[model samples]
Target: MLEVKLHDIGEGMTEGEIIHYLVKPGERVIADQPLVEVQTDKMVAELPSPGAGTIKEIIISTGTTVAVGTTLLYIEGEGSLEPVSEGKASETPKEEVPVLLKEKNEFVSSFNRVLATPYTRKIARDHHINIEDVTPSDPSGRVTEEDVYRFMKGEQLAENEAVSTIVEPEVLAKPISPDEIPFRGIRKQIAKKMTKSLFTIPHVTHFDEVNMTNLLKLREELKKEGVHVSVPAFFMKALVFALKDFPVFNAELDEENDRILLKKEYHLGIAVDTKEGLIVPVIHHADKKSIQQIHDEMKCLNEKARDGKLAAADIQNSTFTVSNVGPLGSTGATPIINYPETALIAFHKTKKVPIVTENDEIIIGHVMTLSMSFDHRVADGATAVAFTNRFASLIEQPNKLMLEMI
Candidate 1:
């Protein structure tokens, strides 16, 4: 028999919520097959099988949060210990990921069956509602936000019994909206992580306006030959180049040791907004990819992120994060750090502005704000200023970026 333990999904991710199991006990699995889906504070990922064998038992279930090194499952049979020598590299398995619950059954009243965290359950109990009566929208039938609203309404109804008896449902209401949304699965994990991020970290933001007129002109000139370019692709390319010049921005923080760990490779994370929430998919070795390659890869990652088809690997190991709010008409924003990275850069809406040249010539120019948030503990004001200045210089000099590309 062999046990598969959860390894380090990423730095600082000590625990993850088990979303679900793809395979059941007594089922056959191949080497590299995904056994469980887990949602960490940073991203959602699938844990894979190390060897081909018959399934033995599942140690965790949907909605249960387990820590790193937690033995998730056991496999029994031939080669389970030795591991199958399949030379093929594992790809994230393709499957319809259900939201953080098992198959829906009639609601259970026991607190054990409720998928809420300790705090949520406490709130529900204080509100005097049966937790089971709250219907969950998640595939696991886990209670959600709407469920809480419903329970609260039930409490209000009990308090105003006289009005409830007189009010006719059809006469007073135009379709009662869903009342409670249960906190279960990835959504629940996202909430927990964001709450922790917001509260635990003292966040501050700095903003600057950048003139991208030259870069835009260069991109338009390239578009004639069907060499399409996107703003993010261009920004990422320039940012990577700037990082090479200003290495301090690329470093991560080791809080316990009170040291800065500088990274050699530039892995840029493109924040992909989805229906579930915001997911940042990392493009590994981003500095090495061409503009076309970055464009194509970003397209694929963003599609998967939106479709919820992303695997665990899709969301791991980002050295830096970029949150582009230009698409949403945002001129500027204060972005929260992904943590340990020490900084995050946000792209804002680009527009035209008037500029006066050294020769006393005034002309219309394009401008955009590049907002940056840094961990004060790691990066000082001087370093942040130098990094942003270098980045802005590169963006202004489109020819330099083009030459670096060649």
Candidate 2:
């Protein structure tokens, strides 16, 4: 028997919740076959089998959270075996065998064994509803406190027809306590990173407005050729060009050595908003790829991010970052800097506004506002302003990007 230990799932992840087990004891499995689905803070990934063998036992049950390097199961096979440490298998009652055998039931129903946070379970208990019956809306398939409240509201509405209700003035005047949500998973990770960035780095923001008339026309032209381009793609290309001229923006401060490390390669980080939280996926070598190539790659990365399929490497090694709030229809925002990176650029919504041309004539044109935040320690106000101006020039006159495309 060989021990199948929970290996490192990368991205500095130390622990994961066993979402479900695909195979059972005595089941013959092949190499690379998915043995279990483990949900980390970033994503839900399938842990594959180590070798082709019959599963001897499952040491960890579903919904169990374990750290890395813990024994998950054991596989029996023909080999010169070495002594391996094993974990005790979870004990289940014989009468519960029928429930466990049911393939549709992914979770093993037991005390404090539901795939939910303590807050969610508390809300469920207060409402007198089972957490298992609450439909989970999160991508990880874990029940949330909101789900419990929603279930309670639905039940209350259904029973309202059978009962009469009266509102009291004292009850209405009483202040209600706000529900506190515990920070965990991706939300917790975001909070930690944001706090570190804000407290550690002295951020200076530079705001500018760009004439996006040319960019809009170019996007239309590209759409006609069966190539769909987005605002973030164009901004990413502009950032790469600006970084080439101002390499200081594409650098990180090494306080230990008291030096700045300037990166030669342009690995642009694109911030993607998902149902879980905000995740940034890096587009390696942004300088080498054309605008169309960037668009295609960004599309694939966004899909993976929303589906929680992004690997650790997909998010690593970013020299510069771009956060586009245009999709949310915001005019502008002062975005927080992604830690370790020297600078971050944000693109706002493109709108039709009246512009004064070179002849001082008022004409309607497409306009987009951009906000860039840089670490003051790495870059000064003048350098950050110059970089933003260069980026705006590229966006206003998109022919420069078109030349690169050709």
Residue 300, model 1: Cα distance from true site in angstroms: 2.1
Give the residue spans of candidate 1 off by over 4 A.
1-12, 22-35, 42-61, 71-178, 195-202, 404-406
Model 2 lDDT per residue over 267-378, tens place:
9988999866788888999989987799899999998887566876888778888888886898878789988899998888888999999999999999988889999988
The lDDT of each candidate is 0.73, 0.78
lDDT of 1 by residue, 12-56 (tens): 578888765667888776657777767676455677778656688
**How accurate locally is residue 395 in candidate 1, as Cα lDDT from 0 to 100?**
86
